[model samples]
Target: MIDPTDFKQGMRRLAAGVSVITTMENGQPHGFVATSVTSVAAEPTPTLLVCVNRNVSCHDVIGASRSFCVNLLAEPELELAKAFSSSAHRHLRFSTHEWRALATGAPALMGALASFDCELAETVSVHSHSIFLGRVVALHLPEGPLHPLIYAGGQFDTLGSRARTL
Candidate 1:
């Protein structure tokens, strides 16, 4: 049998861009640093999928409200990523970031590379996490060049290129 630890270690090698999934519940904002977000479809409507830990505050908010914003972090936003990733003292962490509500009433970061407001469409439980599928309702792309924040091998990195086309 394959060891779980080995499987985890192997999966960690796959690099992914970083994002913060945000939502509001009971008038309070909640967010979590996530790298498990992916674009699933772009057919009749844009769709995205995000896997979140079931025990996190953001998870609870998403479950209650069925709305969220995926904030694609820029390279300079490592501090924001670190703040949201902390499990201890989350309320304090939230106080350090500037946020505004999107069309879906989900909280979004002020200067992310891009932000997507979405409404929940489906959910499925998988082991320790819940996979949430959302349909895009609105998108915001701020003016100016962008440098993406990337995560790999348990560390945060940056994307340097600003070219839109390959």
Candidate 2:
């Protein structure tokens, strides 16, 4: 087995796209910056998963509403990511983003690289976090070439297109 610290460092080397998970509760909107959003399956049904800190406000809102939106952030939205990631006051962070409720009644961020409105399908609590699996009910991809915001080794990065793939 690898040493724990070494394992963590190795995992940190893997780059991940950043996203903001949003939801509304009692007319108040909440969101959090996350790098753990991922597509789980397309067969049977389209689904996505997000792992959230159990103590965060979005976590509670997701649990209560059973719905949420995953907003894939673009490279131009680094400030938005930082704002949502801040622990000072959630309301203030939410104020900066334009939000609208989808059919599922979840708040979806406007002008994202993409947005997926989802219904909470399953959850599993692990130590200090909860893994939420959501089934996609609505989808939107705005007109634009996406330059995704990325995170790796605790730093923000940008994704560039490869000419070889063109």
Q: After superposition on all CA atoms, what RMSD does each candidate show versus the true structure?
A: 2.5, 2.2
Q: Top TM-score: which candidate number?
A: 1
Superposed Cα deviation of residue 114, candidate 1 (Å): 0.7
Residue 150 Cα positional deviation in candidate 1, in Å, after optimal superposition: 0.8
- Write the residue-wise lDDT of candidate 2 on 8-54 in tens digits: 79888999999999887888777888989989999799999999988
Where model 1 places Cα greater than 4 Å from the true spot, the runs are 160-166
Which whole-number lDDT from 0 to 100 does residue 39 have in model 2? 94
Give lDDT tens digits, candidate 1, residues 1-166: 9999999899789989899999988887878899999999999899999999888767878988999999999888888888888876576656776777878889877788899999999999999999999999988888867778999888998655544455
Residue 130, candidate 1: Cα error in Å is: 1.0
> In candidate 1, where is summed lDDT lowest over 10 consecutive residues?
157-166
User: What TM-score would every model get versus the actual structure?
Assistant: 0.90, 0.88
| Root-mean-square deviation of Cα positions for candidate 1 versus the true structure, in angstroms | 2.5
